[model samples]
Target: MEEPGKIKLTIPCRLDHVHLAGHAIKGVLAETIKDSELVFLIELAVCEAVSNSMQHAHGCNADCNVEVSIFLCNSELVIEVTDTGAPFNADLLKNKQCHDPEDATCEKAAEGGRGIFLICRAMDEVKYKSFADRNILTMRKTIKPTDRDGEP
Candidate 1:
């Protein structure tokens, strides 16, 4: 049974399956957030998290599974992505190397860390930890009164 104000989903570790989670996130956030871009960014952050779990943590292993939990409390939205494959390096959160997309000097070889960087940029808070065999990545965003009330 799901808790009130929360939605949870489990998906096989596959890049193709990531979109289902994204759609679910968008559906939930779109209800109160009138901003389509904000909704999209949240969805994108989730998709990246799921994709990283499938590709990095699970090594694209179809046998593993990823769990996503979303919670809406007061004006905050919290999301957690969990996997059992491998623990995430929490240190990366402190040293995310973000590049300016418009900078022509940025090297394409910097492909390794953009996912976590984007996730951090999109959410107000992002955290990762592992205990026993479970690794959980939690993300949070606070919706302003104007955002929820659709006030200009």
Candidate 2:
């Protein structure tokens, strides 16, 4: 069983393991959150975070580890994705615009670079930091009272 208000999942830095993180988030939140859409959004944000950490940070090396810690506090759900690989420039997050899949004229149109944009759109608040040798991406979402089946 998971702890009362938090759950942490550590997975190898590989693309195949990304889905595990997503499923774990959905399973934990689905128990108390009745809204499927909200749960899906959270899951998507987390999966993108994990994928970015694995591909960009760890370079898809399975020898590394990515830790995802999720906390349910009062009316908010906070998720932190931590990795010991290369640190990123958090400032880039400020410039990400939501990528419209249908915009053919967009100069930046590509298969990548949309992770940060999607994450920002899904969560209420997003933060990124690097200290010492670790990089952590923290995302927060406010859960309205009606979204939960019971008090968090």
Specify the poorest-scoring 10-residue window by lDDT in model 2.
97-106
TM-score of 1: 0.89
Clashing pairs in model 1? none
Q: Model 2 over residues 2-47: C-alpha lDDT tens digits?
A: 7687888899998988999999999889877998999999999999
Segments in model 2 whose C-alpha atoms lie over 4 Å from true places: 1-4, 98-108, 150-152
lDDT of 1 by residue, 1-152 (tens): 77898899999998889999999998888778887888888998999999999998999899999999999887899999999987777888886556435555445545466888899989999988899999999999998878774667
In candidate 2, position 73 carries an lDDT of: 84
Task: Give Cα-based local distance difference scores for all models.
Answer: 0.88, 0.90
Question: Per-residue error at 20 for model 1, in Å?
Answer: 0.5
In the order shown, the candidates' Cα RMSDs to the true structure are 2.1, 3.0
Structural similarity to truth (TM-score) of each candidate: 0.89, 0.89
